[model samples]
Target chain A: MSRTQRSLQLAAYADGEVAQAQRAAIEQELAKSPVALREVEDIRAQRAALHRVFIEASPTAELSERIQARIREDRQRASGRTWRIGLASAFAAAAVIMMSVRLIGPELWHQELVSPPPLVARALAVDAVLGAHRVCSTLSDGTAHDEFRVGQKSIVEANRILKALRAMPKEGAALPDLSESKYALSSACACALVSNCEVVHATYNSADGVTLSVWMSDRPLALSGASKLRRVSGEGGRVYQVAEVAGGYSIVQWDERLASVVLCGEMPADQLLKIADRIQPFGSAARPTVGPRVAIVEMALLRRS
Target chain B: MSGKSFEEIALPHLDVLYRYARRLTPDAHAAEDLVQDTYLKAYKAFGKFELREFGVRPWLLKILHNTFLNGEAKKKHAAHSTEPQVLDTARAAAEIGSVEGDLRIDLDGLDDEVKRALEQLSPDFRSILLLWASMELSYQEIAEILSVPIGTVMSRLHRARQQMMTLLADYKFRGRGEPPNGREAT
Candidate 1:
């Protein structure tokens, strides 16, 4: 090859991308020409210099969370559009199923059908979307078993409910203050999908009768079909996911290091996002522990936000 | 691929992507946004192919580069004038006799000079150079990311290194082990 052609091939040779025959040819050129040898050395130096200069910036943990958050936003927007398109069709199909089941099988039905089951068997078998579906449609009443009063005012009541569910005790982590929210505390429940996998459900109602429920558990509900599920880094570095159920409700689930939380209501996406943003687990009032490395990271990011 | 597994594979490269993105767009905020947009796009379009460790880096970087280029167009901002400014500075230095008798670089200032010399190259040359030097991607992989033939990668890499060397060759180092103080040798 000519000197110029050989020079072009030298980079590929240095990068180990050239074929054996071409590599041999380039090696010959390197041996024969001192100028070519110097060129190769210059290329090596340039590579080292570039590495030293360019790759120094270390990305913050916030950057990863932010990237994940953007991905979640993109996915939600897409799935939201899909669900909107299928909303009418889904409702019609659901109505048909409900009517046919009710009309055909009186003996097969029970009053318990109106209450949310201890477990969303099918939803748990599928993903979180279907989990949301089961919670929204079946758990319409939003009542915690009568012992823990639905409208408890303090952390003691929340502790009572948590004990009932056998949830891990998180010092200083309390229910988000919703007094100024459009919704007020109305009902709460301790429900489980399977024994030992307890989830505490707290329901709130607005004057207009629109209800919002929050479920807190030790672990995020793990269902079989998880493709319908996603983890999002919500505002303030809170990781959450929004799954729109068949009914007109959106369920936003998140993890607070201390607990897994789910917020569900029939509200617009923006409204739900706003509520999610407000539901901080470790606000100044709570005075949460800053011991764990994870908690420290979360607290720092949340405080910044 | 599932979101969990995709996160496992892709999240580790967040810093790598951010570093490249920062170089592509000098503005820090713009670089962050670019990285965010790149991940968003990559996640939406990601498939089983990206599950492979080898394939994911180039794939993610391709998205980042394309996003940066498109973003520049969208914002109608000049595609970072650091290069032109550096070239102009170099030219004006030559004209005003910035180099006294010889082309001498203060040993401490070699890094800054090398960096400025890099900025003096066009985006295409700078990008190709950085990909090879900083990321150490294979020629085939760089070609794939840039959507150019492997031969083109070879040529560009050669030209980029040559340009930098030409710009830098005249500088005589002050001495070894001194931190760059950005001063001209008297």
Candidate 2:
């Protein structure tokens, strides 16, 4: 390597960032020239010292989660529609239940019998829109996913999309322990619970120093005090939730706002309160005592069988 | 794209994102959380993600970088105590199991003078060095994360090394500030 290249390489060499061939060439220079060798070695020392000095610093996990949540929330707002929300909700339901139930998800049955879940519905709409974009991006490149209709340039290439999705590898995460309930969607409230809970699961682990967890959803519908749900509003907006029921557990309810989201779990009221505090612009609190959790709990319980 | 479900797409990048965050933040708690944020952002934008030839790793990294920089830059304007001083803890014998007061680098036989020289560079410089060292990326990819130009990336790396060499040659080791055992020339 020339002297200039060797000098350019010093930082990368200290970092061990260079490729094998490049590294070998640099090493060859070090052997041939004492100055080159001394210079490279000096950079390496600084690199090591810096690592030892700053080994413990990193970004807070909360910021990362918030960013992701912000993106998710933005996308949701962009495709604003009840049907879309419903499908997206259904998907949120399925993903949560898939964690709490059998690997062979029963949401498929729900997909057929019940209207497709909310998250799924939303994605389908987006799939249609993005599918159009995909086709456009494709057609712009001169290759059509399918033979174009003689006059219809606006139509999506549905078959290709379906094929790609089917061929895609699964989206993975740290799944919750689901040995309990079949799916969180057996009841309408369960759907709400899953969405809120999964957001917690997705979000809690990543905040700085503040430990966040999405409590396990136990099956067999064994927990007591589930029937006493109370609806409350927080900084986000009006929250429909259950409170102070069986198991000393309160139902935290609220929307996934741009800056606020309500939570419901078996965790301490203090911790949940702290979560609420961290998320701002919460809506006013409401105590609309929804009908006994009996129907909802019964629905969830029966589905466990 | 459309056909692929959530698990198929987002999970694979978690570990790498975590490792990157860990290095950047240097604090275990902060790194864990930063990694999670990277995932959530990835998940939400999964629909918008297209299969560009450059790949998702870069995209995710770009997001992570933006998120981190946003928070970090905001904090920079916030007031803080005086900068961290050079803490002289007895090179914790258990850490590298040294003899008397010597520093032993188990990863390699490289000596202590080299180790301190590294610590002198700023975090940003160190990050650039690591990105270059990791070899998992090309110059364009590193530029994307660091938000620098291909040419600037080239120049910054050059300057970073020059700084390191100058810093190392001037450093004083222990009390004497001379090479250990007075062996300046190997």
Model 2 lDDT at residue A44:
59
lDDT of 2 at A213: 25
Q: What is the lDDT of residue B15 in candidate 1?
A: 83
What local lDDT score does residue B72 receive in model 1, on the 0 to 100 scale? 38
TM-score of every candidate: 0.45, 0.38
Best-performing candidate as measured by TM-score: 1
Q: How high is each candidate's interface RMSD, in Å?
A: 18.3, 15.7
Whole-model lDDT per candidate = 0.58, 0.41
Clash tally, candidates in order: 3, 72
lDDT of 1 at B138: 86
